[model samples]
Target: MSFDSANLERAAAWLAQIARQRLTARAGQLVETDLGAFDYYEDGSWLAHLLRRHQPSGEEFGILMLALSPHICPHLLDTVIAEVRPEGGELPELGGVRAAGHRAMLPTGETAQFFFSGMNMSRRFDIEGMFLADHWFARDRILWLESVREGEPLMSGRLIVNPEIIEELVTGKIGRPAFSMDFPAEHIETAMDWDDLVLNPLTRAQIREIEHWVKHNDTLMDDWGMRKRVKPGYRALFYGPPGTGKTLTAMLLGKHTGKDVFRVDLSRVVSKYIGETEKNLSRLFDKAENKNWILFFDEADALFSKRTDVRDAHDKYANQEVAYLLQRIEGYNGLVILASNQRANIDDAFVRRLQAIIPFPMPQQEERYEIWRRTFPEQIALAGDVDWRQIAARHELTGANILNVTHFCAIEALAKQTREVDLRCLEEAIKREYVKEGRVM
Candidate 1:
């Protein structure tokens, strides 16, 4: 409820600037001036909350979302930046990041027509300035970003601010702000089936289907007159044997798209408390909706397993979890992957929404042989008499299994002061891997 002398000074200075701007300005009004157009939203909310011991209201909230919108309409950012001219205080800058990169500044009066646009906007590249502004005077502040992009002929303007990108933008030097979360930059969508990753024609075809939906450009599928997304985008179900590349495929896709992939920890996501599962799923979906990340749920048969008759309370709750999961999967705007070894275990209701379904079955003999051969480094010293066919005939390992066995074999060969993996050592690893699976070695 009380602020230090410095805090009082900031709040005073900020409030003074808010009074200077007309917060009710409509979208048609061109923002060409000072902090007067921007109301102090976020900082004000925190102040009011601290004072009243409750949540802030109006322009006090949604500051982060407003600052991040990609195409802000009617020059809202332009107005905000004009107002933010070198206030007495400046924010801290991490190494190599400019002042603008850290936060954005804008005027308070720039809402109205851009209300919805600003509410969800986020993540525009270089930040320009940052200032706290309020929308409607319900006692709160909103953080605003000030930046611009090159515009096309539709408006005959050089500046373009996107309102669509509202979610990932953060203001101020605060650590771990929701808008500052880093989306992972790797995934399986980048797999070049024929050129980079070795795969059979069928696998390549399936990859093409996924790629088509992913908006792969080289194929020109969009301009080629296809009216719809090949598979569209729904949470997909990938099932088969492990090491058959289910995880690899997911990672490849994420990597290709320059998005992060997050594998949900079902243990943390599913809870015994009522509505806990829905809450957890909602949080993940909300995060993924705005952030650049692919949600992957591996070994998901436990979470997404078929629902049985609700005779018991446990069964009823389990069914509720399934229903919640289905809704989340359908609502997610980006790609989601659920992988399980037991395809039969997934409920039929859940299965119907998959945009693309691909099996990662255990490799056939030919594929297995190719996997084994590729598993080793090209320059490894070979006895020249290595029989891949014989090895393939003898080993029942999947690509992942083969990769493990070969990696171990290579290390063992090195330990033995030999450049090439010997049949004896290779057999030892293969036997160990097979025994783990309860197969006769």
Candidate 2:
């Protein structure tokens, strides 16, 4: 007593009727909406599905349209619909809500029997009741209720979906809307030239490498075998003193790659309750599929600390958490950057996973000079007598401190009613920095 044939026949007969009624409507009104287009797409069943979702008075009005499918009697579907119209523009429940198919509601929540001709497949996180497709936005993604693997042949063979391909489609280091379906206005990105933007103060070569990777990571991943292989990505560790452009480099990389750079908000990921942190991270990855994102964990050492000799439950659970994180990170398909001021705090196992450990050493004398010469824009006028070289040499501060001193000098020089920065004003800025750092400059 296979219901498969009976169910499909009932559903097909239902859809053929819909096509005939739509034809009677004034031209150019049909096929105007996602629902309309979907109803008309290969079969009108999709519209039937939507109607079932809303469950309005005349589910049969939409159900009748399904008759248009080649296999159904279109004329009979139209006849049934014409016979049931309420004269006073009234709405009522159509009889025979039941079909000879699967025990599914017709989107009407009316316990209407639905025949599913196609197979539906989805994964659950066993413990967490989350959908794998939750990682995608509905507008940008096209989700098929049934598996297309057994369906008609395509330009490429039947588009059989496997976990490998879906996972590839779901994970990214940087991303723009899962292959460019119209995204929301809020998600749309505004373009900026990382190189031409004057406000950024990162080094040319380092910035260029980040940019090149952003622009050509497809080639890199393919060459490195990360595309098809199950390997943890070669990590790139960024180490430096605070406020010296490490964060800026990461953000610029996201801008270059056409995706959002998310600073993994630690508050959201870390929890006081045991095993909660791992679960939180799992949800984050589930929601981040294929949107080539730059995930920045600013202070990575909190999670990547060295393993300890276990004596208590706390110690064992902590080690388990680390192990779980390593597994998830290895499987992650996007760009991963961990930034920290104290590199020594990160465990060797974590360090070994890194592909590039770029040390952001404090700027040298010449680099510091460029930092000064370029820091003040041409919009602001300075006296020709002001010496940038003297400032860079005398300050001997980190690049960030130099920027601060330059900022103060600009304010002070302007207030003195002079366009040119005076030696005295610059000296005052240097003195303040010396006091803050407790240096004998």
Candidate 3:
């Protein structure tokens, strides 16, 4: 049978059995109760028909599954279906099952007090309830339900299952939460390595440490329990001037370690509302917790700046935000790189929490020469008049600046209808870059 058909049959059979048992028990008839044979509907075949009938869109089903899987269980789902599907009715209500108590007559001749009791015994009981209560489930707004009525011991809310959950259950793959303002791996896969990066001794050592941490993270934390004694995460600071390769280094670290680099957009994270920033950050950290992604905060001074005296409400809230960030940073077991233009701009207290603080200084003349030479594509012919030493010495540019100059020179050479990048073109490009920076060439 095909995937959908198979699941549909399984769901129909499972639900039919549940419905028969439910009806028989209601009529005070003997019900077979062997739960060993009735395996937990692991494949989510039980909801396949209901989902197909209600939500025909496949993409919608996938999305709903991504959001609901973390908060749903098979027994709860079965109970929900049983409550809505009447004995001889048409389609059941798609809104959700009412949180009314429904007894499950087990196949082993044992009575489960409530259908939800079976759900409670699966994996982690009431864990989803805690997650739902704390997090804003309404934000996804896929699973809408009524508020629990007073004196109702059972949860009275409606449990609207999204098509995504059904799809996931059928496929057996739980999707990650769709978090806003966080870049995923696919977004940064095309990031180029800094071939011209001139790493000093200290920087090299720090990079090694980061690599070791990533490789042996589980051993140190789980096997050794070092994480329990100290902060679980490796926090580092990349402080340097613009165009000095801080951002590139972070990306390279992620690439080398086979981890995704999520560059946090501080503009989106730091909000004007009091608690909103924390809420946004909480969502980010929570989603990224177990996912081995390196959290890269570029231009981190904006958020990690020194705490000021509380002259007003803004200052107090700002400090509170910093404190909350510190807590989250300490709790995270993965790698987090905070890139800042100036180390002084970052808080002293925050700096104390770091495992490494590698400074990215401006490339020296020799390094600059290397950068200029390496950055120039071998495909592009260099004119005999083009002087690498003169260019590198005269214009003390960062690796990034050198790249920009090379690109402009190439384009200029192309525009002039020449394959060779001549001295005039290179000089003019370098001069233009300096001029753009508000500096006299």
Q: Which numbered prediction scores highest in lDDT against the true structure?
A: 3
Q: Candidate 1: where is the Cα deviation over 4 Å? A: 1-200, 216-232
Q: What value does the lDDT take at residue 102 in candidate 1?
A: 27
- TM-score of each model, in listed order: 0.60, 0.57, 0.71
- Worst 10-residue lDDT window for candidate 1 reads 123-132
**Candidate 2 wrong stretches, greater than 4 Å:** 1-114, 117-210, 219-226, 230-234, 383-385, 438-440
Candidate 3, which ten residues in sequence have the lowest lDDT sum? 105-114
lDDT of each: 0.55, 0.52, 0.64
lDDT of 3 at 204: 67
Per-residue lDDT over 1-441 for candidate 1, one digit per residue giving the tens place of the 0 to 100 score:
322223333544444334234333342333233322223334443333333443433233333323322222223343443565335333211001123542434322233213312222231110111231232221222222233345621111111122222221222112222322232212224334433344555765776676555555324434664435543244677888877877777777766666666777777677789888777777666546534467788888878888899899988888988998887777665678889998898888988888667777777788878887777887567665568888898777788788788788778777887788667777888888888888898
Deviating ranges (above 4 Å) for candidate 3: 1-113, 118-154, 157-186, 194-196
Give the alpha carbon lDDT tens digit for every residue of 342-431 in model 3: 999999988999999998988878878888888887878988998889877888788788889989977877787878888887888888
Q: Write the residue-wise lDDT of candidate 2 on 76-147 in tens digits.
A: 433544554424242222211223562221222110111111011121121011112452212223221222
Worst 10 residues of 2 by lDDT: 109-118
